[model samples]
Target chain A: MVSLYFLLFYINILLIGCVLVYIYKLRKLIGFQLGMTISMVAGGFFAFTSGIIFIYVYPFHFLPVTIAATLLGMAVGSIFGSFFDYQTLLSGYSNGLMMGMMSPMVGAVAKNSFLFLSFAECLFFASLLLVLSSARQT
Target chain B: MILYLYTMLGINILIPAVLFLTMKKKRKLFTDRYGMTISFSASLIFSLSLGTALFFTLPVSFSVLIFISAAAGSIIGLSYGILITFQSLIIGLFNGTIGSLMGTMLAAVIIDPSLCGLPSQFSTLLDRNIILITLFLTLLSLLSSLLLRFSYRV
Candidate 1:
């Protein structure tokens, strides 16, 4: 069961990586405002999912989980934000940081509910899809 | 350990205060968009970090922590927004409040992980974890302030 959850976590990460690459390729077409929105959604969504999945996996190591999630959020936000402008970067970074810090706690609260986890994963996928579609339109 | 936490909190407060003062010195030079960004990010980061620190440093008093943090966040936002326009002020106020609320919630969970149904740790481990998080948040606050300062160049 734990392995299954771990696999799901990695798959989500892989999907995020793919999205990042796609966004990078389309960086030229997106406007500054859209870029900030894209980066914020990506960073916050990924951080929230990863944080939840991680906490659900290892219910013990709270400290490390929080640290990892926060860093992950910061890294994703900055990378995505860097594609646009300094203000975009700042917006993404702060949003990601805030979400990252809050996520593991939310995961912890959800406890052993696989249903909630699945819903979170689905939301992430749906949001990513929206981001890609919007980017393509741009 | 309590003393150490208080010291960290003071440092956390000071970093942003310095940043706010430095930014204040040049409010006349800021462009409109830049002013908004500064107001938004500064207040958000300030409220979040301070809220977390207060929750961790004080005793387990959720009501007090929440009230203080929310007020602190709104004030920070208002201060930054006051430098700009009505729109920026509103943005600052909302973001600051949300950010502080989040920080308080996170701190609550950290202090008592059992709130999430996970088995809680021993006191020593919990203290150590609190210290580590505090240090990490301080570093984050510093990095963000540095980023804000460098925005002038970019």
Candidate 2:
């Protein structure tokens, strides 16, 4: 079960990396509004899922997990937002911070971390797919 | 310790106040996109910093903290968003409220570990962590505000 969790964790990271590449390739085509929304959603969900996973893996180290997750969210948001305008960056950064801070609590409260993580991952994937389709539409 | 927290709160409040004045002075010069961006970012960081600082200073009542933070967030949103347009107002208000909500929840969990299902044995460590997180949040807001101001020059 632990190994399975680790596998899912790595896959998620890989997916995020792929999305970043995809965004970078089409950055010129994306409008500022869409770009802002994309960055905000992408950064937020990534941080949130990662936070939950970290908390689940190391239930004892709440302090480090919280700090790490927050920073990771900020970094991801800034990186994604940097592709477009400063305004996009601002929106993305704030959204990621909020989600990152909230994720651990949500994770901790769940009775079954594995099931919750799977559900959250599905949501994250769905959101990313929506973003990608919308990006393509534009 | 209380004095330090109060000072942090003051700084957080002062940031948005100064930004509002500056934006008001140059309201006419702002483009549509810039106005929306400023409205969104300023209200968000303002509420976030305010919520966190308030929670840290007075970790007394959870319900009260949530109410206060949310109210402060909405007010900041209205003040900043109203300067631009109805759309900006909606954006600012939604983001501000959400930011404060998250901030309150984060602070709550940190203050009381059991609230998040963590073991509640590290009381001393938790106290120190709160101070560190508060300082980190203040610096984050400071950096973002500086960036916001710098955007005007660019």
Q: CA lDDT of each candidate?
A: 0.87, 0.84
> Would you list the clashing residue pairs of candidate 1?
none
Highest-lDDT candidate: 1
DockQ of 2: 0.63
Q: Which stretches of model 2 miss by more than 4 angstroms?
A: B59-61
Cα interface RMSD of each candidate: 1.1, 1.7
Per-residue lDDT for A19-134 in model 1, tens only?
Answer: 98999898988999899899899999989999998898889998899989999998999999999899999988988888888888888888779999999999999999999999
Q: Tens-digit lDDT track for model 2 on B25-144?
A: 777777788878887777877788789898888756778878988999999998998887888899889978987887787777777888867877566787677778788888888888
Estimate the TM-score for candidate 1: 0.95
Per-prediction RMSD in angstroms? 1.5, 2.1
**Candidate 1 ranges with C-alpha deviation above 4 Å:** B59-61
Q: Candidate 1, residues B12-64: lDDT per residue as tens digits?
A: 77987788788888878888888777887888888888888988877746777
